[model samples]
Target: MPDTSFPGAWSVDAEGSAPPFEQLRARVLDLVTSGDLPAGFRLPPVRTLAEQLGLAANTVARAYKELEADGIVETHGRGGTLVSAQGDAARRAAQQAAAEYAAKTRSLGITEADALELARTALSLR
Candidate 1:
């Protein structure tokens, strides 16, 4: 599990690169998607993640809310947030999309051999 700590002072990006809450959301999503954060892995509490990221507690709360809305994460009483097991649906969607891509690529003049290779390589990365 990644270590959790309080950041103490809030310092969101003034450059507008991405809102603090959005960045937090994206990072959590990527972590969950890449399997770096596995299913059932607990997330830092909103206050804890907010403090550690130098953000407002409300920002973290917003991020978690968005994650939950998208079915990427879940919350339970005071137990904290966690990656969703519903990730299976997301994986299925990705597989279907990949199948469509493979067909489209072949139709676009990509050789069957090359398309197969592409699918293999893409699935391998997952």
Candidate 2:
């Protein structure tokens, strides 16, 4: 079995502005990006982590699904989920988002220079 104990305590703030599943997803993503959960680190099974964190299995499952969709984690049949290589995963996710943004801007008839400027402004805000 994969280790149930992650590097730090994990909790879902039921009263927080974000939903529980999103909070969990963000926490796991933060861990991956921060190098606390290294590449190839297997995460606990959904039910097991759900029990530990007092969340519904579905909630944990949704978080894992979103993480996998974002390329931050890979799910193996019966082998469990493992963190992806941070640098590569982050780059791929960013590229995909940029592509989607570009498509949307084009569909909206935004000029290339305007789109580029909007992107630059968003990056600057970050």
Of the candidates shown, which would achieve the greatest TM-score relative to the real structure?
Answer: 2
**Per-residue lDDT tens digits of candidate 1, residues 6-29?**
223334574666788887776777
TM of each candidate vs. truth: 0.63, 0.70
Residue lDDT tens for model 2, 18-99? 8889988888877877788889999999998899889999999999999998889999979898897652687667789999
Candidate with top lDDT is 2
Count clashes in each candidate, considering only residues at least 3 apart in sequence or on different chains: 2, 0
Each prediction's whole-model lDDT (CA): 0.75, 0.85
Q: Report per-prediction Cα RMSD to one decimal.
A: 6.2, 4.5
lDDT of 1: 0.75
